[model samples]
Target: MISIAAFYIVVSVLAYVTYAIDKQAAIKQRRRVSEKSLHLLGLLGGWPGGLFAQQRLRHKTQKTTFQAIFWLTVAVNVACLLSLTLYPYGG
Candidate 1:
């Protein structure tokens, strides 16, 4: 449980920072972080922070396609997390 919590915490922080960087890049018209990478981060247990960053930074909230995919990734991550907790391997 501790390990799982720690993993989420670390990944969430990474996701939040990545979103911030991506937002700044967009404003500056610089190279942007790919949508796939953002979604991958969320799928890897960072959706909470990614969601927070979206509202907090007002980033990535305008695209319906991205929103749809992001929510799908969130659902998938939650399902995986529940499975790991409820039916831990080899138990």
Candidate 2:
């Protein structure tokens, strides 16, 4: 349990940093992080950080398709967490 928590924490922080970097890149008119990568991060349990970054940085919050996918990833991540908690051994 502790390990899982730590994994999420680390990944979340990384995801948040990725968003910030991508945002900065956008401001500079440079190459930005790919949407697929961002979605992958969220799928890997970083959705919370992704959400925070989206709101706090005011980035990627306006695209309807992106928001839809982001929310879906969040739901899937939450469902996975719940399943793990209820059946740690994969009953």
Candidate 3:
């Protein structure tokens, strides 16, 4: 359980940094992080960080399509987490 929480912390921090970099790139008119990449991160249990970035940085909030997909990924990730918590192996 502790390991799972640590994993999420590390991944979430990485996702947050990635989002911040992408936001900076956007400001500088540089190459942007692909939407697919962001969604992948979210699906991998980084949705909390991605959401934080979205709200704190005000990034990627306007696109309805992206928001829809992002929320879907969040839902999937949460479902998986719940499954892991509820039915832990070797219980």
Candidate 4:
């Protein structure tokens, strides 16, 4: 539905924005966004932008754990989107 698409778009944009801020903080404050926060966002359907940030900002890609977790996040988000598309609620 349009709502779902909008949700995805909003979340992706938020993820990119969050990652950009995190990158800036890392440069200025010597700290990155908390792993929990990043994971939560990705899990909530921000994986694409998280991935973009990972590649663009080069943040959180060095750790093997993060790599695995990031992929998992992407997978989960995709699955959720698929479900939303295939099974409309009360339709």
User: How close is every model to the real structure, measured as TM-score?
Assistant: 0.94, 0.93, 0.91, 0.82
TM-score of 1: 0.94
lDDT of 3 by residue, 1-91 (tens): 5687888887788889999999999999999999999999999988889999999999999999999999999999999999889988935
- Report lDDT per candidate: 0.96, 0.94, 0.91, 0.84
- Identify the superior model by TM-score, candidate 1 or candidate 2: 1
- C-alpha positional error of residue 44 in candidate 4 after TM-score superposition, expressed in Å: 0.9
Query: For model 1, how does the per-residue alpha-carbon lDDT over 1-91 read when each residue is reduced to its tens digit?
Result: 5699999999999999999999999999999999999999999999999999999999999999999999999999999999999989836
Instruction: Give the TM-score comparing model 4 with the true structure, all chains together.
Output: 0.82
RMSD of each: 1.5, 1.3, 1.9, 2.4
lDDT of 3 at 14: 82
lDDT of 4 by residue, 15-37 (tens): 98898888899889876778888
Q: lDDT of model 2 at residue 11?
A: 85
Please report, as a residue range, the 10-residue window in candidate 2 with the lowest summed lDDT: 1-10
Candidate achieving higher lDDT, 2 or 3? 2
2 or 3: which has the higher TM-score? Answer: 2
TM-score of 2: 0.93
Top model number, lDDT: 1
Which residue segments of model 1 deviate by more than 4 Å? Answer: none
